[model samples]
Target: MLKKLINIVVFVPLGVLLIILSVANRQTVTLALNPFEPSDSLLSVSAPFFVFLFLAVILGLVLGAAATWFTQAKYRRRARSEASEAVKWHREAEKQRSQAEKLATQASLPAPQG
Candidate 1:
């Protein structure tokens, strides 16, 4: 469908770009976690530059998803309450409908002649 076409159009180019970047940035780099001791190997990780690039992208996506989920919690709660309210109303309507039908049948029945 259109979604697949859009994915192909968008992701194909992005994939190619990522591949190019990985190829161009094959040089190894070290990420130092110890701010006080920048040269401390114990708190550092070394990998290809593209590894860090991809990790950052993945981390950003995870954080963004979490933020979006947290922000939309109120809407989700409201939807749940609305759904329960609808169910309650529907049950009340059905009860009323059955009562009306019972009265209609009773009224339709012939009275015994005295």
Candidate 2:
């Protein structure tokens, strides 16, 4: 219930704000890829203002996610190894318990009175 309210409060206004911004800045602009030339550029793109703005935002998100994944890789590896080790120990414990129970049953049997 709280999550839905928070989403509505935050996302609705954010969406409306973005729509207003895009509408206000609909003018086309030229983006020059070549750094050396300013007046005349061979590599360039002509797109709406919102296109570049959204592209930068998307790029930032992608780069940040990549960095986070790489940074936490060691932790993920350690957790996987720990999980496998725990499983091995658990199997060994069950085997020992079964062996003890079998020994107890054998000791309870009567010996030959020759």
Candidate 3:
């Protein structure tokens, strides 16, 4: 419930602002890919300015997420190693417990008659 409220508070205004910006900047702009020929229509893309703005924002988010994932790789490796170690220790403990129970049962039995 608290997460929903936070999302509503943060995203509602951001969505409204982006909508207003797109509405206000309805002009078509040309982006030229070839630096040698500035007027080449074959190497250019023409679209609304807001489209480019939104594309840049999306690209930045993707790059930031990728960087964070790469930086935390060491911690993920350590966690996997620790989990395997814990499993090994637990198996060893169970084996020892069963052996101890078997010895206790043997000691409780009566001696054989001569």
Q: lDDT: which candidate is best? A: 1
- TM-score of each model, in listed order: 0.92, 0.84, 0.88
C-alpha-based local distance difference test score of model 1: 0.99
The sequence of per-residue lDDT tens digits that candidate 3 reaches over residues 1-114 is 999999999999999999999998789999999999979999999999999999999999999999999999999999999999999999999999999999999999998889
lDDT of each: 0.99, 0.93, 0.97
The TM-score leader among the candidates is 1
The candidate 1 region of ten consecutive residues with least summed lDDT is: 104-113
TM-score of the candidate numbered 1?
A: 0.92
| Total backbone collisions for each predicted model | 0, 0, 0
TM-score of 3: 0.88
Worst 10 residues of 3 by lDDT: 24-33
Model 2 agreement with the true structure over 15-111: per-residue lDDT tens digits? 9998998998899999987778855656888889998998998999999999999999999999999999999999999999999999999999898
Error of 2 at 62 (Å): 0.8
lDDT of 2 at 108: 96
The parts of candidate 2 lying over 4 Å away from their true place are 39-42, 108-114
Taking every candidate in turn, the Cα RMSD to the unseen true structure, in Å, is 1.4, 2.2, 1.5
What shift in Å separates residue 96 of candidate 3 from its native position after superposition?
1.6
